[model samples]
Target: MEINELTEPERRVWEAFPRGAAVDLTGAPEREIRARVLRSLLLTAPTEDGEIAGLRLLGARVTGELDLQYGLIPCAVTLWDCDFERTPRLYGAEFRQLNLSKSRLPALWAATLRVDGVLRLTDCRIPGPVALAGARIAGALFMDRAVLGTESDGSQEWRDRAGRALQLDHATIGDDLWGPHLTVFGKARLDGATVTGVVQLDSARFHHPSDTALDAETLAVGTDLHAMRMRVEGRLNLRGATIPGQLNLAFARLANPGGVALRASGCTAGEFWMREAAPVEGALNLRRARFDLLHIAPEVWPGEVRTDGLTYTALAPVLPAADRLALPLRDPDGYVPYAYEQLTASYRRIGDDAAARTVQLAKQRRHRTTLPLYGRLWGHLQDVTVGYGFRPMRAAGWLLGLLLLGALVYGLHHPRPLKADEAPAFNALAYSLDLLLPIVDFGQERAYTPAGAYQWLSYLLIAAGWILATTFVAGVNRAVNRP
Candidate 1:
């Protein structure tokens, strides 16, 4: 289109843009460039040496829908220090690059927008929702130091409410999603989003108390999800998500009292880091989650941590076996079988049989605390007799004690012989052995019987022998079949 043929607004934008480099339109009159005029100038700009330069609008007040539903932007579009009267509705817009850093917009409805280069919205103040559902970015999505959501009114209700703040659902980013030190007063939804690189929210603050502050459900991050030192007032959901790299929650403070503060159910990560994290006020749901290694400390582990179906291959090398079991044993819910299983399996994976046995024995003892009176008594009996299937030698020790007691009693009694052929000193030790071992008789038990209390000793020996022998056999069987 010729310069004379262009409309007034189009001519202004066309004449204002310098060829081959970035132009400063800050000194120009504050004109509200309509969408059609802006589109016309961007599509058919002046040629310079047989090449058209990209349009960079700086410090311009843009109005109307900057919609590009039917065409592709041939060059980059940069906006800086611009104020939009309405939400930039660029639904299905395709461009080489987009940078709206330091701009003020009510909202962004860029659903399915395709950007070949970087989409930088860094340091912008967006008080309304920033939706990018189904958009594809070939480069990084940088929103670092951005201030989102309304200002706090000091009302608890207002602080707790999580109005829609940021949405990236189903959006695909070729590079990282780096937003450090960013403050969001409401929820930041990344549900079903895919990032080829890390999703770093280090030192960020999310202040939504009544609802979820960060929801990244089913998100697939190729690298780590680093949220170290982040302070979240509500739950952070990553249920069914998969992170090929670590999910580092170290030094993070996530608080949602009486509700789940973090839910990573069915999520799989390469490694999990929770070392030195602040005490979570609510439950940490890790049900069915899997990780190769877990880096956590007992002091920072919350009071209520669900471990059902949660499995880890190894514990951090710095963590001792005792410290690992200490957390689950301190759970107020008492013995959680899966909690024990998680520890045992982790130790077993590292071929540490001794540690696995220790965890199993601790699990049995903890379980006994929650049982009825009779059940507890049975557990104690098993403990003294067989050491809960971990120590079969204890049963052998009891058997030896009983055998010696029977021998001393029989010798002191000096029973008279029933058979005339048997002598008075006819091997009293043999007689004791006969009574102590129920399976064998040696003809001494029936040949002579002790009178009074000595007779009671024979029956006691017989019952003790049966109980000890049965317990020893059962314990050995359990130890053999446990692995």
Candidate 2:
């Protein structure tokens, strides 16, 4: 429709749009664009060149509350370079398209808003928080190169009140949410979000030290979530999040020393790419985390990685026994049995039973080393007796030692035979054998009773036999029950 054919309010909003063959709104007046006028134009705007001729209120200072709660806005809205006296209230509103680029707003409360097209806020200055909780954007939400919160003036008040710079809790985006090079002062809340496309936060800077800087707990991203080179001053909470694609965090710097730097408990990802990244200073909790592939060296695995329940299908370059055990052995809170169990299972999954056994043995040895003096002594005894229930050959070695000692004693003593009817072919080896094997009595003990040192030797042989028999049974049971 022509400008003259429009209603008076519609004409005013249309006049705010730059009038030229080449439409550019770089010099519009700071006219007060009320919510009613914008709403009217959105509901009844004419089409131009197959596009909903959007009301471009460029350089205008929009006033009043734009309360479109539950209202479906029909036309595209572009308010470029505009200054808002108050942030628009578009809670639960549905928009065809929205572009508030280069605009200055106090805050944005667009929770549960539905955008069919792009929600562009590039280079915009938002002094306060931007709440997008439960929002559903069919297209991308672009906030590239934007300034999320105001710069700190060394004021403790502003620092203390910085709760969330951008809230995206439970939001579902059909396409990507690009926010590269953005600066956020507080947490970027993305808990429970389902992004069908990538959530790229490359080179973003977050400054919320000692607390969560980016909380993406339980988020499910259909594709890769790239946060490469992003700098987080506080913790990056990804607990229980699932990424069907790779999670790229190469060169990212996370600093929350001695606290939780990254909590990724119960996370499942297709591939994890953190090769050559800056080390996280604090604890990196990875309990129950499952990944198909890991793109990290055993040496480069963070010193504070808590891997009590971590499992991976394969390592990019499979490491040796020493390297594979390094990360789990660095658990500051002491030895976690499940951590070794997880490594053993991962190795077993890849058909590396030797590596799995190595992990199990390392676990036992470490446990023994950390025990009390008497406990360590008992553990050594168990090792010699049953090979900690893994080495049955050690039991045979003990049995052989006892047999030799008994035969030497019998040969030296030359004990007299108790039975006169027994045959004269007396063999020392046969006598030792009869004493050692308690189940089979070959009349050797009944036939002769040793004297002096020979008597003590027989007692020693009988006790050693009983010990070895019980330990052998236990070792076999352990081997059978193991998975």
Candidate 3:
């Protein structure tokens, strides 16, 4: 395209491309620029001596599809506050940087696109899906305050793509994905995506009530995934994700009634901060998830939480045993022993032995419900005597009470000696001790025999002693053998 044949507005952009000068078309009558002319200039425009050439246009009405598929753009391309007549196609294209900030577009199809520098779509209004699947971005990708997707048009295609407002499936971002205050009318899918830096989606709003709002399953992030104060109308699925840094969801509002609100099963994070968040309207599934520190408020937990196989090294705010027990106690799938064990282990890791023992006692109490009638009876005996081995002092109390009772009964009525020559002193306390201790022989019980009703009292004392011994031994064995 010769300079003389170009339109006045086109000539200005063409001349400014070599020097990387901005051609602001705001409030100008002639704002229309052909996408083909811009593409041609980007591919063949000559740069000034020692000057980096870039096309920086502002407030232009770009007509026709900007099809740069498989093209290698030499210079950075920035078209801020521009209006696109159709969706730009950049599939398999390579660029140094690409910024379309504050632009109004029908959609953006940049699947398999490669960028050496940052890609900014900040504050853009895109009414259709933005596909970035398989994109490799060296620098951060910013979509802050960007609105993607519109209400359904009632078509089958629209319905099928309803949950996919922004698709970055399998994409690899070398730097952060900054999208604070973003609004996605559908799902923001990042399945199998990898980010080398933090992913900030703080204060973002995702609306896809019937399906997943943010599907980042199997995503691997190098740093924190900050979605603080974010609002999601559907499930926030992070299943199998590995975030080495914190996954902060403070003050987030997640809603998916009767379904999984936050499905993060098998996820691994350093710290999971969910304090001060709204009570989830549905089940919070963290099954098999592992975290170094889990910071959550006790009152903020939903009615249902699936914590089977979940393991956290520490818990924040240091809640009591009863407050922490609410997690496993409210598990929809009943009798998950692993959940209680993990909680007990967390308490133990924090050096809260009392809380750990409390959790262990609660676990035994919960397990009692799943036993047979005889097993439940046995469990009740163990609980009353020793608190299922968690409360060791209870066993001592039972022993003392039984010993005192036995001594009091036998003291008032001295038993007749079976053999006067072989009998030891008739000490009531010594006789009671000998009767209570099955293995210890003071010879007082063996030498003397009670008569009449006193004989029945002796039998009762022997039976109680045996029962107490059995319970004590069982509790001690359980506590000693437990890991």
- lDDT by residue (243-298, candidate 2, tens digit) is 99989888888788768888888999999877777877787888889899877766
Query: How do the residues 1-483 of candidate 1 rate in per-residue lDDT, one tens digit apiece?
Result: 456766454465676554645545576664556666677766665566655577777777777766566467778888888878777777888888999998888878788989998999998888887878899999999988888887667686555444678888899999999899888888888899999999999998887776798889999998899989999888889999999899998898989998889898899999999878998878788879999988887777677877777888888755556778876754445577988988887877777766787788888998898899999999998887777866767888988888887777777677767876864445677887787777887888778877888878878888877877777887777656656
Judge candidate 2 against the unseen true structure and give its global Cα lDDT, from 0 to 1: 0.78
Candidate 1 scores a C-alpha RMSD against the true structure in Å of 3.8
> 402, model 2: CA deviation in Å?
5.3
Number of the predicted model whose lDDT against the real structure is largest: 3
Between candidates 1 and 3, the one scoring higher on lDDT is 3
Estimate the Cα RMSD of every predicted model relative to the unseen true structure.
3.8, 5.0, 2.5
Candidates in order, TM-scores: namely 0.85, 0.77, 0.93
Please give the lDDT score at residue 292 for candidate 2: 90
- Better structure of 2 and 3 per lDDT: 3
Task: Report residue 46 deviation for candidate 2 (angstroms).
Answer: 4.7
Model 3 spans with C-alpha error above 4 angstroms? 2-5, 151-158, 451-456, 466-483
lDDT of 3 by residue, 1-483 (tens): 777877889899999999999999987999999998887898786799978899999999999889999999989999999999999999999999999999999989999999999999999999888999999999999999999998656676765777568999999999999999999988789999999999999999998876798999999999999999999988899999999999999999999997888999999999999889998888899999999999999887899998888989888878888888888888889999998888888877767777888998899999999999999999998888778767766766787887887789889989999999878889888888887778878889899988999788777767767777776777676556654
